[model samples]
Target: MKIHNPFRTALVATLGVGLGILMITSIQTLSTVILYIGTALFLSLGLDPVVTMLERRGLPRWAAVLITILAVLSIFAAVVLIVLPVLIEQISELVDQITPLVQNGEQTIESLKGWMTETFPNLAVDDVFAYVTDWMAKEDWQNNVAGWTETIGQGVLVIGGAVLAGLFGAFIVLVLTIYLTASTPSLKRSAYQLVPASKRERFIDIADQITDSVGHYVMGQVSLGVINGILSAIFLSIINAPFTAVLAVIAFFFSLIPLVGTLTGSTIIVLACLLPGVGSPATALAAAIYYLIYMQVEAYFLAPRIMSRAVSVPGAVVVIAALSGGALLGLLGALIAIPVAASILIIYRQVLIPRMDQR
Candidate 1:
């Protein structure tokens, strides 16, 4: 391995560095594509268990894959068809209510003043209200509204572009997921062929365990989200919360993220319960209390049962993994972090620990 010519060695080293930089640049440019592939692979792994269950029930692999895909698509379609209209209507209503307040500063301030006075009868708010009213009166409400209108127009354009891009990305991921799920066994065989024959069995074992763990974790997380969504809808309806359907949808999606999702969703739900016309302090308080209790029940009771089959990552490791992953790759990273951590722990325990012991 000794180099005879120093210049030749230097030239080779420089070329290697340049090639690495080129590769890095290429990867950075293709990061979005990579993200889509990773998401597809993750979802395919999650679908593996369902496909396996169908196979066990005497269905052919193709049939299993077809059924799984159909089931998922049906669920998604049902949600869009049943929930989207109601969600849009509620959002429109909210916008309508907010528009008048923004348009009429005087009315908004007067309403705020009245609320403050009624909520805190002992506090003298006359001077504060007068100052606020005078300051608001000095500003040009028409000009402000014009500015807001312009901003909203620009925002709508941006949102429309983003939505188009998102839809395209989703379609790509969906196709990739279906392909990956269908060809998973063949793909695994091809990959295993690349490994040294002597070590292939061990590799397969570890790979299967990791994939199984990932599938279980995804299923468990989805179960938790569904439970949260259903219960949230019922409870919010009982309390006459504004936009209950929207809030429940929010709860479901947020609950898919680990650790902080429930807390973040709960905070939003409570705030929504305090909105004007449809909410009161009592309603907010009630929502807050319910969430606090629900969090405890989820942590102690539901999560354990649902997630029993998934690898048990340590709490500290889960926290660190989630934060680091989120910092690195945003939401996708956070979603995959715990399972990745579990996989790493598996390797450490099975390989590293044994090697160290041999030493």
Candidate 2:
């Protein structure tokens, strides 16, 4: 052990550093592809339970996997087809409405100034509005606001090369998901071969539990999102809300974030009703009432039933995991955070706790 040469040790350390640098650079360069691969893997794990259920119900594994993929794609297609047209129309309508909205805002500000002048004669609050009104009335201000408003996040929606690249990335993810899901058994077999012989059976059991937990969590989240979207769509349509489909689609994404997401999803709808001076203030009030009732229904009834089958994490842990993951990796990070926390808890309980008890 003491026969190490200084030159040899130095060369090895230098090579290790060089290799690490190379790996980091390569990962950065191919980050997009890597992200797609990770997404596909996540989807595969999430959907694996459904595939297994189908297999247990007498369908062949391949047939089960195919059916699951088809079901997923069908849902995706339906969302796109149903929501895309409405979203486009809503964007156009929103742009057209902006000028009137701005004008209404100016009127509201003037009205507020008048009210302040009457009620608070001693206060200089009215002067604040006067100064703001003068600044907002400038031609440059109007054009600048209007110019950005007209564009309306249009760059991302445009059918350009950038959009096509996004489509390509999606296609890759979709293909990988299907392939990986179908080959799950093979992957498991190969993975088991890598485990130490004595622990292989135990490892498989733990792995299965983890995978099942992941699957349950994913399905539960998706179920919650779909329910939120459908309910939102129905309510918005019933109320004749401005962008029913667009808001519903938005709800679907927001609902994927746990707990606070419902509030956020509904807040956007409420703000659209209230802030867009084109609409009645009552619409916003109605939105707030509806969401309050719905949040209660979700917390006491829906979430309990839906999330029960998934690995349970403490409420405090859930919030911390979501925040930490979100800070690190944005939406995807937040989405996976709870399940990851659950897995850690599982390992601690089954592995660490037992070992500690024995000691």
Candidate 3:
């Protein structure tokens, strides 16, 4: 006899599918809200120590929150004011230089062909140049330009919408952060009351440890990115590379991605150098090689030393975490991978290891 309840089964299936659809829709519609909430929580944790310090100095919680937010906004505004125009100019120059750079590259190829034909008498320079020029001319640059323009126009609309949504979400998170920070003690007390009396202290300790771990990781990552940006700018300047500032900024932003970011940044820098006519092919090759070596050194020496202090997870664990995180959540997964791994390690150390030892 079939004992299945058809109504119950249908309800369960419908609920599951509905929940999946809701999640997908939320990712698209409320993405800005998610981003804001995450960012605010991260920032709130980092600023907590400062807030506590201010409280000890006799300032109210609201005053501390106001001070922190104003300080952050002021610094952000300063950066935009100082850097935005220069970045815009550099980008415009880079775009304007592209067509001329391509023409020069074609000319360079033709010159090399001529030399090859002269050195080896049987070589056909005419056919080679003809083929090269034809290929270059057939690049459909106009179509590409038109397509890029269309894409940019669409991107602007999407970005504008996102920005508006982000602003709204940010307002909400800011309000929530102020309230949460002010009521943190009461919130903790309430949370602890929910737990069994025996485990209450242990739960609080675990929660605090997790908070500290995440806070340190965020601060460390930001610090590392800044250092990388400054070092990149200095190196690019020494090499007399065009768009040094722009490349530095790009490097800083991309360096947020774990292992692969440096390589990506270096590739862009090398390609930019190649276009500028300042570096010969040999020089470009040397630059790429130099960057690869630098990346290796940074990965092996700099990253471990910097990140070890922030998150105590081992190298092997970090690699596995990064890979798993990337697979799971793409960029966001990778960004928080180390911290997530550290949390797991913390849990294992505090709970599992202790239990195992006792047994």
Candidate 4:
């Protein structure tokens, strides 16, 4: 279509541009609000399955929700009261152990090289070790590392302000989560009312499946984290590994993130087991071997069983979805990616494929 009047066309174009700019500015301003709401909604969905299970056991919806919320609060309180002190103490000890290494880069590098050589005599690491040593010797790399370490150490002091802000934000999220969880059914009804009557039934079916998938996935992931934490705690305690509680806590939280979390946590745990005065090569080797086996079991056994029930996504698709999601929005994106992908797969299988076949 050609514009009949240039002045009117230009005016409309300018208005459109202004509107677009306004939208971008508004979104930027409300980014934190958006994050809080999204996180709360995600958590509410995760809590839904537990609420439903309680309701199935003959409790009213409100009662079920109350019980579930109370249980969650209890868990949170326990972590804060019982675990936080131990975690803090162990972390302080860990920092103390790391202080010497941070101050002396050459010694740290040499120690690391010696450990690697001792741990795996057959591994060809001499050339790589020489290169690293040479690099560290040149360009005052030691000071640079020390500077970075100092910056990180100083960051702990500034975290008080961020912690206060985070607490306020967390309270908001908790309140939102409670409301969302309690009103989920009504919310679904309200949403369904907006759909055309002809399509509403199908929409409800698909929507329910998607929500169920998300809820189940959350539960499964949490279960995996719990398992990892408990097992790590037991194994570490058995082997007399330093900071068993702290390491287990790390394992738990990190395992909450999808695919890469377990491996990342495992690496940290292994490294922690190799701390200069506190840890030995034997302990680090044992931790490494245990994690290697655990990863295999989780991938081939545990994950397949738990995740298969939620979404029958292909392994390749799962990896790609997680990577893409993580790239786009970090942790939250990665957590949401699988269920979102599952929802898409459901639509493809139940809706699009049928329509295509008809065509």
Candidate 5:
């Protein structure tokens, strides 16, 4: 007689659901790991050429790695030394000035309102002022300030941890870079062997193109960001803008985000300048106009020249990639969008373009 397997079925069903959940959790964790590893690997790949050149001059792999790591660390240290003190000072100043700034802004608005009332006698200036003062005095305002302070404190701690992790990760990447660079040819051959003999050559070719495109794009963007930062810093210093160092650093990071980034940076700098009484509204307006013109030149001339030499991605594709990446992943996605787009473009050219041509 055949017995019903109700207990076995229930056990199997429960185990299956448990395993599915575990698998999903594992995949999420794995994805995070892969993202971190991929970032390090890409950096390693970009630095590999330098390692190769040194190795060609008879330097041992270990020595090359040490030198590369030292150079990176030294540059990082120098930047921190040059910029950190200024940033800290600016931040402290900003915090101290916040209350006074708010009071000044309130006064400015009130003065404007009074003028308007005198010009147009029917206007309710007193009512407007009362509303503004009430808004400022609200419980919500205090809550917001308290919340902001807590968030800032937490952010500082997180940043400290992230910096430590980044330093450790950099060391790991340096070692891996040296090893990968030294064995790149062998690695290529091994990778090619994994493909069927008929497809090996094509696969290798596509891989090489992708690597070159992505590496060049990354390097070019970094170069452009550095240039923009230096130029911005010079301009800010010449103009005697408050927080010039902080604003320049902000410009540099934002410049990594492509089209809208520079505009955002410029607006921020202009607003900060307005607060410090360094410029009248008209002067701020003039600076903003200058920034717009400069951005146009940079976009049309500087960007195209640099990007064309680095990667052959189309303008339309870059815009779309930036918008989509920004929408999906905020600033991080925007920063990597161009390289990601270039990689996709490489895949399309290598894989799909030929297939379409055949058809």
Candidate 6:
């Protein structure tokens, strides 16, 4: 005959609730730290293929890691050095050309008004202009700004803090990536040791395949981005497009997105081409045509060759993963989405389906 202690149970429940609350609070507070750690781990995985390639060529592990890091950093440095000055100069040139661009816009507007007046004698351009002007006056954005000064000030502070945090996060990720990359073998061994002896071999094999896929995905995406940027620069320069360097850089980053990246990037470039001082509708049309042809080439030829080593995710899976990830974590989510889908798919095919079949 045992008596249940009500007081003791209540106290235990209280303690458990308190502990859960503490854990939630602690996790919220350390969100940024977790973000950095995850970034570092992903970067290490992404860089592993390069490291392994060098290692296979008889380079020591340390030497392989160092070479891989150096090559990546060197290319980044070169891009910054070449693109920065050109970007700045292009920006300044845009600023300098703005007055002309505005004048050209006004002239076009005037010509359109004249044509409309000639075509429709009763059409009142003055009334239309007055209505637009009145609508603009009604908005009074200055009053909104005045009312939200404190909110705006807080926003500015938040932006500044975010920028500082970004820099710190980058540093943390770099250090962690270097350490993890160099120590991966030992880390894997230690991690595997935690698994049951019977399952360890299977776990290792699956993990190896998944990580290899991750590495291949990263390399393939990077190669495609470089190709996209270079091609954009060539085409934009040929058309004498304004802000070619900046547009190319934009294309480079946008090309990281799967499926629709090239189309999105091309749209942006075409719009820039349609700018008053930049390019005309004819040039924009030509640019669109060029990208259409390029997109087919990339899809049918370039992607297959570059991504041969990576596990293929279906188009629907790629799209859903990218959208879901982007909705959750923006760039990082989108960047990792495909690889995540690939990993899940690998598990499904190798583990889940086989087990189901066995059952």
Best by lDDT: 1
Which candidate comes out best when scored by TM-score?
1
Pairs of residues clashing in candidate 6: none
Judged by TM-score relative to the true structure, which candidate is superior, 2 or 3? 2
Looking at model 1, report the run of 10 residues with the lowest lDDT sum: 133-142
What is the TM-score of candidate 2?
Answer: 0.85
TM-score of each candidate structure, all chains considered together: 0.91, 0.85, 0.72, 0.87, 0.76, 0.87
- Runs with alpha carbons beyond 4 Å of true place in candidate 1: 1-7, 120-152
Query: How well is each residue in 186-218 modelled by candidate 4, as lDDT tens digits?
Result: 999999999999999999999999999889888
**CA lDDT for candidate 4:** 0.90
Model 5 Cα displacement at 282 (Å)? Answer: 4.9
The lDDT of model 2 is 0.84
lDDT of each: 0.92, 0.84, 0.76, 0.90, 0.75, 0.87
Per-residue CA lDDT of model 2 for 1-359, tens digit only, reads 68469899989999999999999999999988878887888889999989999999999998999999999889889878978888999888888767664578768666656666665689898678668768878746866877787676676467576789978988999899998999988999999999999999888988888888888899999999999899988997887777777888888899998876788888988888754334556777887799899989988999889988778888899889999988977888888888889889888888889999999
Of candidate 5, the 10-residue stretch with the lowest lDDT total is 275-284
Error of 6 at 14 (Å): 2.6
Model 1 TM-score, 2 decimals = 0.91
Q: What does candidate 3's lDDT look like per residue over 21-127, in tens digits?
A: 99999898986667666656666676666677788999988888778767767977887787788789888887776666567876766656655675558977788
Superpose all Cα atoms of candidate 5 onto the true structure and report the RMSD in Å to 1 decimal. Answer: 5.1
lDDT of candidate 6 over 117-158, digit per residue (tens): 765689998788778769867987557767688899999999
Clashing pairs in 5: none
